[model samples]
Target chain A: MTQARLMDGTALARRIVEETAKRAADITERTGTAPCLATVLVGEDPASVTYVRMKRNRCRTAGITSRHVPLPADTTTEQLVGTLRELSADPGVHGILLQHPMGPHIDERAAFEAIAPEKDVDGVTFASFATMSFGLPGFVSCTPGGIMRLLDEYGVDPAGRRAVVVGRSAILGKPAGMLLLARDATVTYCHSRTTDLSAAVREADIVVAAVGRPRLIRGQDVKPGAVVIDAGYSPGNVGDVDFDSAVKRASLITPVPGGVGPMTIATLLEQTVDAAARQLGV
Target chain B: MTQARLMDGTALARRIVEETAKRAADITERTGTAPCLATVLVGEDPASVTYVRMKRNRCRTAGITSRHVPLPADTTTEQLVGTLRELSADPGVHGILLQHPMGPHIDERAAFEAIAPEKDVDGVTFASFATMSFGLPGFVSCTPGGIMRLLDEYGVDPAGRRAVVVGRSAILGKPAGMLLLARDATVTYCHSRTTDLSAAVREADIVVAAVGRPRLIRGQDVKPGAVVIDAGYSPGNVGDVDFDSAVKRASLITPVPGGVGPMTIATLLEQTVDAAARQLGV
Candidate 1:
């Protein structure tokens, strides 16, 4: 059998970022103001700091401004909310990003919601979730939005297909499934509480593994000729899907590091520019 | 074969309305303000008129006030939105129900969005949909909320079950599937674009038929011991499910007319009182 084709999200994300950069440049030149993204990190978690740094670097490269708001680990929920509200009201801020796992003490949803819907470029707020679920015009969660861009680039029409989403995070699996369902796919959502995960996976025409469990979806779980998306990256470069074995069965597959990761920041930058264009009336 | 047990939605709805009436009475006696529901009808379609009248009658019997706003068929979208916004701003209006099929000329979504999230007792706003999708505490679309109540009343836990929701309407099928997913059920959504509806329904442990096609789901489509909810009502009192055959194959099934209909109004009144309590600080 021929080897499965790799859905190169890296290349697609690069193209998207390039387009976004052009648009950002046009807006900056026309309006004399660059689109600004406010990165709000509640604590000094190493991983979150690195992620925020990457996003900021991407924003700079895209001709966008990145404003960092680093708070103490013990920041109260009220303080975080107040800070977010200030960012939301700022005329210069086009998008807002709040790093997650904010020490588990702060009310994350409260803080995320404090960001205005127009500025919810990371798409964590309930307002954004609702719009995404309803297929309305608004920003989507970065990762899931990237996943859709990859699927579209590959000409994967979700309509009438059995697409199983193997996780239900608010921004990732849930929104991905909703986007697929909006396109007329028969969408099923499976998670940790699921009784028979393999049974669900085996029936999918497209499988999106996002449970953050390394190699949880083995080759046997993937249907022959199915498309597999590994959105979860556990430690040691392992993905939610056992890529080596799944690649043998799946007709298309996404590699871990080079796939979903780059698309996220790409989508964030793209949306930030879009938000700025709208806000600037360009 | 042993016949499926009937899920008595009428009895359950009666009990719910009785309790809601008691609460409304309590709120009125203490605050001197009865829970008020504003029913806005655009044009006088016979069926929509009947639905609004039924809801108003139910509200009266439950000791809740019903305020009607009737607009002409040629009413502009802005006019309707202005009316809804006015109702949303009115301190006395605790709940707002905009009857469906408000003529094709009107932008239905814009009209629905005009109702404040607090007064959106009919649960049609994007905010309400977002909250319902996130499993957050908020009002839900009446019919789907009623279906959930019936499921809980029957002690049917959706967790770990295969739930296939047939239909993708804004209020009914979409929210029903989301609610089931929130309870940990592996929820699948099937719509008109589904290639083989029977194949999708056959895998379901819980089947919700809401596509408005009479007798679309037959006995062969139902899995043994499955809980079937027929939320569709076609002409001549027919349901989406072929009740005669499905009753023999399924473990639990709802009957037409008496099953899902009464529960919708009951949930409306219950949520109205709840919304009033929150608004009145009682």
Candidate 2:
């Protein structure tokens, strides 16, 4: 059996970043201001810290400035909201990224709402989700946005396809399914509560595994010649899909480390520039 | 074969309205002010005018006060938005309903957004959509909310069920699917672009027909013993489902005119009172 062709998100994300860099440069030269992304991190969660650092590095590489706001672990929700409001009012900041899972004490939704819609580049706000759901012009959640780009790059049209999304998290699976639905795909959302996961997977022409369970989707469950996208990244560099087995059955597949991971930050950078351009009226 | 049982949305809606009326009376007695719903109608479209009148009549029946703000057909987006904002800010107004299909030139979204989230009882704003999608504490689109209540009334547990929603409209199809997904049902959204609509419908344990097409879903398309909620209304009182055929196949089915229509207004009145109670601190 022919092995499934790899959907190289690394290569695609690189091209996207390069294009975004050029736009960032053009905006900077024209408006005398480089695009800026404000990264707000509350508390010292190791995973979140690493994610923020990586994003800041990407911003630097893409000719965008990064402003890091490191809040104390015991910072109150009101204080955090106040800080976000300041950044929202700051004309210098084109985009705002709030590193989440903020110690479980903070009102995450309230914090997200504090960011202005125009600068909500991370797309965590309610406004962004609504726009994504309605297929209107607005920023998108990064991981889902990247997934769409990957599909576009691979010439996989979602129109009229039966796309099964095996997750329903706000920022990831939910938005991903909505984006697919917007593209005219018949989209099904299945999560942990789903009674028959395998039955749903078998019917999918496109399967997006995002439930964060390593190897939850196996080769036998995958329909022949299906397009498989594994957006879930567990510890130890494993994805939600049983990649080794799935690749044999899938027509196209995204690998764990190099697939969705790279596209996320790439999308963040691209949206930052897009926000900056719009903000600067360039 | 035994015929399908009627969902009886009209009876349910009457009960709901009675309960809402009691709440409205209590709030009015305690606060010395009835719950006020401000109905903003843009343009003189005959259909829109009729809808606004129906809503106002429902408000009166539920002991809620209705304030109608009629705008001329040539009203600009700015003027309409300003009127909505004023109503949103008014302490006397507990809910705002902006009757839509406001001319081709009007920015409908902007108008909807003008109503503050607290007063968005119609659930037309982006904030309400996000909350509904995320299963958070917020008002839902009236039609979708009524559909959910119908399911609950009939003891149809959505959890572990397969729900297929045949529409993608912002207020109806999209929110209905999201609501079902939030309830832990594996939800599929099938629209006009769906290649095999019947196939998708056949797999559904609960089907929501909201595409506003006449008899689009035939009896054969519905799975035997499925719970079918026909939320669509076309010309001549026809629905998206062929009532005669679907009633034979469905285990429980809602009829045209008597089903979702009355429930929509019932939900509106309920949410209006809820909003009023919250704002009045009752």
Candidate 3:
């Protein structure tokens, strides 16, 4: 059996970052203001810390500056909102990214809303989500935004395709489906409430597995020659799709770690520069 | 052949309006201030004029006051936005409704965003759209809100059902699908670009025909025992669904003229009263 071609997100992300660096340099040279991203993390969650650190490293690579704001785990929602508001007001901070899964007591939506719409490069704000849903020009949720870029890089036209998104989380599955729908794809959102997930998967020309369930989608469920994008990252680096079985059936597939993960930070850095250019009026 | 039961949106709308009337009266009696809905018309489009007249009549019946602001066909976007902003700030105005398709030159989104989120009874603002998409607490687009009410009245639980939403207009189709998805229905959005609309519709337990093409969904496309909601309105009182044929196949269906039409205005009035109550602290 002919194996499916892998969609190399790592290589594509590198190209994107390279292009973004050029734009960042141009902006800084013209305006003498380096694009900066402010990442606010509440509590000392080890995973979040690591994620923030990785993003900061990518910022450095792309000629963007990073500012870290660490709040105590017991910080009040008002305090978090205040810090986000300050970052939003700072002309130096072109993009504001509030790391997710903050303390349970913190009002996540309130914190997200505190970030000015122009500075919400992470695309967690309601304003950004609205723009994405309406297909208007605005920053997109980084992972979903990266997914679109990857599709574009692979020369995949979403128009008229039957795309089934196997998740409905606000940031990932919902926005991803919205982006596909905006591109004129016939999109289906299947979640835990879906009675027959396999049946839906079989009918898809493009399958996006975004639910964090390791190997939830089996090979038999995949349509032959389908484009499979496994956006779900579970423990042990396992994806939502069973890679070994899916590779034989899919025409194109994204590997777990090197697929959506790299594209996300690349999108953030790219959008950070874009936001800076817009703010600096360059 | 067993004919499908009609969803009877007219009767439901009447009930909804009656309930809204009581709420309006109670709020007025307690606060000594009647709920007021300000309708802004950009141009004297006949359809829009008629719609505004009808809405005002309903407001009168519900004991809610109506304020009309008419602009010429050559009105600038800034002028329209200014009017909306003034109404949004007015303590007397509880809800704002802007009649759409405004001259094709007006920045409709700018005008919609001018209405305060608290007074956006028509639910056209981006903030309202985001709240609806995320299943958060806020006003919903009137027609989509009415569709949910109809579903509840008929004991149709959207959870776990296969729902196909045809059309993806900002107010109607998109919000309808999002609302269904929020209710745990596996939702598919099929538009003009869909490769096989019939096939997608045939898999749905609940089908919403919102595309304004007359009789686009035939009887054969509808799943047997499916609950069909026809939110489309075309010339000659036609709907997107072929009612004569679809009624024979579906378990429940809505008529073109009497089904979704009344519900739209009813939702607007109901939300107006709700907005007034919230604003007045009554």
Candidate 4:
């Protein structure tokens, strides 16, 4: 069988960031104030630091200002929440991002709730999730939003399709299913609790592998002509899906490093400018 | 073929209401304040009036007081929002219920957002929707909450199950899917935009019919031994699933008038009491 056409998220993301830069420039000129994103990170986890720095670097290229708040590993939930609350009330901050997995004791959800919906550019708030679930106009969680954009870019219409989302993390799998559901796709969620994962994957017209296990989805299990999205990434740039095996079965597939990872930062920048425009009334 | 066991929602609701009434009475006696629910009705539609009256009547029977706010058919969105804002600020009103289907001119979502999350017992606010999506501690939309309770009452464990939800309305299908996802069930949302509804239904281990269509699901499309929940309702008390056909193929099913309907009211009363207890600190 012929190999599936690759969904080039990296190329799409680059184009998106370029467009966002122009919009940011226009907004700054019109309002005399540039878009600003405040990122708070607790502890110096290497991965977290790298992700935050990457985002800030992208913001600089996009003509947006970035504020970084690094807290100690022993920071309490109250301190974190207070810091986020201040950011929420700050008129200069158009967007806020609190890096995930903040130590074991700190209440992560509480910190997310502290960010005002208007400034929730990362779309991690309860309001944004609900709006996405209802298919109303609102900022979506970055990865899921980027995935939807990628699908639209590739002309993969979700309307009436059987789309199976493998995994159910709050920011990824769950919201992804809701977004698909809103677009009129029949969405199924599979996770660790799923009894027959392979059987469920075989029936999908569109398969989203986001369980974070490298090569979890093999080629033989994928339906012929299905759209396979490997949203999972392990250390060393390995994706959840078996790329070699899946490519033979799928009609379309996303490759590691060049797939969902890059799209996330692209969506974050796009939404930041959108938020800034709204806040500035430009 | 053996007939499915009919799940009795009326009996379950009566039991639930009794417990709610007792808790409400105790709280009122201790705090010297009765539980109060603010019912905001827009326009003079007969069905809206009837539903509001039914809720108020039930509140009275459960020892909860009702505060009514009736608006004109020509009421503008700002005026409606202002009224809701005033009610939201009132300390006496422990819970707020905005009857659905406000006039087309009014922005219903804006009005719903006006009600503070603390008083949004009906779970229409954006915050409540997000909390439900995240599986956080917050109230849920009544019909969806009731349907979940019915499933639990019938011993239908969602974990490791494949749940296919038919419909995508904000208050019903969408939230129902989220609740199921929270419990680790594989969920699929099907709606009018879906191409092959029968095939989707046949793959479900559990089916939630919330499209309000009469007899939309037939037995031929049902998987044997699946748990079927019919949340649909028509003018003549008709359910979405064809009872005669579905009963023969399912392991359990909920009846129309006595099923999801009663649970909605039960959940309403329960949330009202919980709100009152929190506000009064009893």
Candidate 5:
């Protein structure tokens, strides 16, 4: 049995970070101000804390300034909105990332909308979603943007291809399917409520597993010669796809930790520089 | 062979218009001014002119006022945008409809954006699309809103259903698929570049034909007991689906002239009253 080639998101992310760092330095030199990203965390959930730290570290490594706003767990929707709007209006902040999974009481959409469209480098606003769905020029959700960069890096043309996105989340599966569709792929979105999950996956020329259910996609369900992307990150470092089995049947695959994960932060850093350039008129 | 039951869009549309007229009357009684819809037609295209006239007549029949703005064929994008913005700002104009298929010179998206989101009763704005896709409460594209009403009227639950939308037009097939997806249908979008259109159609439990191609979906491609909706209207009054053949196998189908066409205008009138209600705070 032929094993699939692994799509190395780690190496590509590094390359992107290097390029982004150079752009950031150039902007700092000419504009007399460094590109800055303001990250807002509603509460200190352990995983959320770790994720924010990683992003902030990446920002520092990429020559961008990171501003952290740690809100109390009891913060109300109005308070969160005010804080986000403040960051949005801050001229020194080039980009804004509001780390989500904020408490149940939080109106996530309202908080996301508070981030100005221009400084919304994390790409979570309705304006960004509209642009992404319509294939218009605008900032895209980081994970989906990273996924597209991976597809381009591997020379995978989505035109006339059958791509099944096995999730319907706002940032991941939805935008991933949209980006693929924008490239002329026949995109199918399968969710938890899908009647025949295996049947849908079996028909895919490319499969994107983004539902956060570990091992939801089995190796036997994968079509031979298909490109398999596991954007799902479940507990215990597991992905949505059963990697061992899928590798035997697929042409290309992304391992969770080393694949889609790194690309997300990379894309955020790259877009931060882009947003800075636009705002700086450089 | 069990012939499919026809979904009577004309009858349903009449019912909707009657209800809309009552709402329009209520608004007119409470407020001194009747709700007004501004129909902007840019060019002398026969189809565009016919569509505008239909909308205007529907407005008058529903006891709403109609304002016409006919621009020249050579109207520039900036000029059309300015005119739309003026209508948007007009307190008397509750809804704005820019009859599309405007000549090649006009930038359609730019013109659509000029209409304020609150007054975008036609639901062509990016704001409307984002809300529609996100399943948020907002005015939907008229054709899509009409289709959803039909689905609800017929008690067709989209949950766990396989829906194939055989087009990707921004306002029609795209919004249709998103609407179905919001209802928990596993939606697959097939378009001109789709490699296996027949295979895709055969797998659908619900098929929405909105590609603007006459008789593109054939009987052999439809699964027995499928629900077929023909939203496409080409010249010669033919629909996208081969209705005669598809009806022999499908459980439900929409015909060309009497189906999907009348619903479009009905939806527009209904939404116009809705916009007026919101504006009048009644």
Candidate 6:
């Protein structure tokens, strides 16, 4: 089988990060203030911890200052909200990044809502989601934002195309569909509530598998010459798509480790710099 | 050929208006205040004038008060913004409807932005569009809102379904896709920019045609047993989808005059009442 062209997300992400670093340095040198990103994390899930550390390390490398706020696993919703609200009101903090999957007990949405819309660099707030979905100028969820960049880089124009997104998570599926719809692509969303999966996947010129089910999407189900993006993250780093099967049918496909993952951090850093520039008026 | 079952929008509209009128009267009597809608029109396009007049007349029939603001054709963007801002800040104006098709010279987005997000009853603002797209609690664009209501009334569950929306007008296509996406339907948006419209249409379990083209979608393009909504409008009551051919394939179909048209007015009135309640804190 002829292999599909793999989208080099890592390379693109590196370029984006480098550009962000330069901008950060410029902003710092000109204004005597570095872009500041507040990283909020609740509970120390090993993966979440690693992700937070990686983000901070990346921030330091990009010349952006990082403010770490590690809350206890038993942090009350009020405590988290107060902390976020304080960060939101602080002039020193231009952007706030609240790591996801805080804890089962935490009111995730409520805590997210506490971060001011202007400082919501993580793009998790209702206001940001709405703006992103409407195609209005606003911060976007990192992974979904990265996905669009990949599509654009690959010369996959969404205008008047059929894009089927398999997932319905609030942060992922819904926003992804909204983003594509904004670009004039016909977008469809499937989820646990959906009765049929394969039939839906078969009809797409563009398929975005974000449901986090490992190998839920198979190659045979993909139409010839279609573009496939697997944003799902599994324990072994397996994507939602059956890469072995999908590559044969897909004209362009995103591989898990090399594709979408890298773009998330890139987008985050870029937004941090943007927020800083706007707030500092530099 | 079997005659298509015409979905009667007129009758449906009458019932909805009647229900809205009763609720409006009850709310007014209880609170010593009636629902109030603010209508802002720039320049006197004959069609726009007629539409605003019709909406105002309906508001009166429902016992809702109407506030009308008329601007000359040469009104500058700042002047228009100033006028809209006054209406937005007024506590008595529960809902604001900015009559569309403003003069070419006008900054439409700027004007729409003047209306507070809460009073954007017409759902034209970026905030409203974003909120609608996110499936969050916010006012919806009238036609798309009506379409979803009709779908629910007809028991068309969008979850896990392939929904193709043919058109990408800001108020219609974009918002419709977001609404469908929120309901978990995989929605694809197709428009003039689309390369292959037929293939996209054929895959839809639910199709919404909002392009103002008359009879553009043929019956052969529709999937059998799909729910079809024709939201297109022309001078002489023409629809976007070719009704005659589409009916043969669609399990349920909304007729042009009797389907989506009535729902727009209904949704408008419903939102006006809702706005009144919220503003009045009742």
Better of 1 and 3 by DockQ: 3
DockQ scores of the candidates: 0.83, 0.96, 0.94, 0.82, 0.86, 0.44
Clashing pairs in 2: none
Where's the lowest-lDDT run of ten residues in candidate 5 chain A? A125-134
Q: Report lDDT (CA) for all predictions.
A: 0.92, 0.95, 0.94, 0.91, 0.93, 0.87
Q: On residues A1-282, what C-alpha lDDT tens digit does candidate 6 reach at each position?
A: 788999999999999999999999999999999999999999889999999999999999999999999999999999999999999999999999999888888988789989998998888887787677657788988889999999999999987777888886767877787788778776767777666778878878899999889999999889999999999989898999999889999999999889999999999999999999999998
Off by over 4 Å in 1: none
Per-residue lDDT tens digits for candidate 2, residues B1-282, read: 778999998999999999999999999999999999999988788999999999999899999999999999999999999999999999999999999878988999999999999999989999999999999999999999999999999999999999999999999999999999989999999999999999999999999999999999999999999999999999899999999999999999999989888899999999999999999999
lDDT of 3 by residue, A1-282 (tens): 989999999999999999999999999899998999998988899999999999999899889999999988999999999999899999889999999988779989999999999999999888899899989999999999999998898988999999999999889999999999999999999999999999999999899999999999988999999999999999899999999999999999999989988999999999999899999999
Candidates by lDDT, descending order: 2, 3, 5, 1, 4, 6
Clashing pairs in 3: none
- Chain A TM-score, prediction 2: 0.99
Q: Candidate 4 at residue B29, lDDT? A: 92
lDDT of 6 at A206: 93
Please identify which of the two predictions, 1 or 6, would achieve the higher lDDT against the true structure: 1
Error of 1 at A37 (Å): 1.1
Which residue pairs in candidate 5 have backbone atoms (N, alpha carbon, C) closer than 3 angstroms, thus clashing? none
Off by over 4 Å in 2: none
Model 1 / residue A160 / CA error / Å? 0.8
lDDT of 4 by residue, B23-71 (tens): 9999889999999999989889999999999999999999999999888
The segments of candidate 5 whose C-alpha lies over 4 angstroms from its true place after superposition are none
Query: Whole-model lDDT, candidate 5?
Result: 0.93
Structure candidate 1, residue pairs in collision? none
lDDT for predicted candidate 1 compared with the true structure: 0.92
Whichever of 1 and 3 has more TM-score, that candidate is: 3
iRMS, candidate 2, in Å: value is: 0.4
Q: What is candidate 1's lDDT per residue for B1-282, written digit by digit as tens?
A: 799999999999999999999999999999999999999999999999999999999999999999999999999999999999999999999999999977889999899989999988889988798788889889999999999998999999999999999998889999999999999999999999999889889999999999999999999999999999999999999999999999999999999988988899999999999999999999
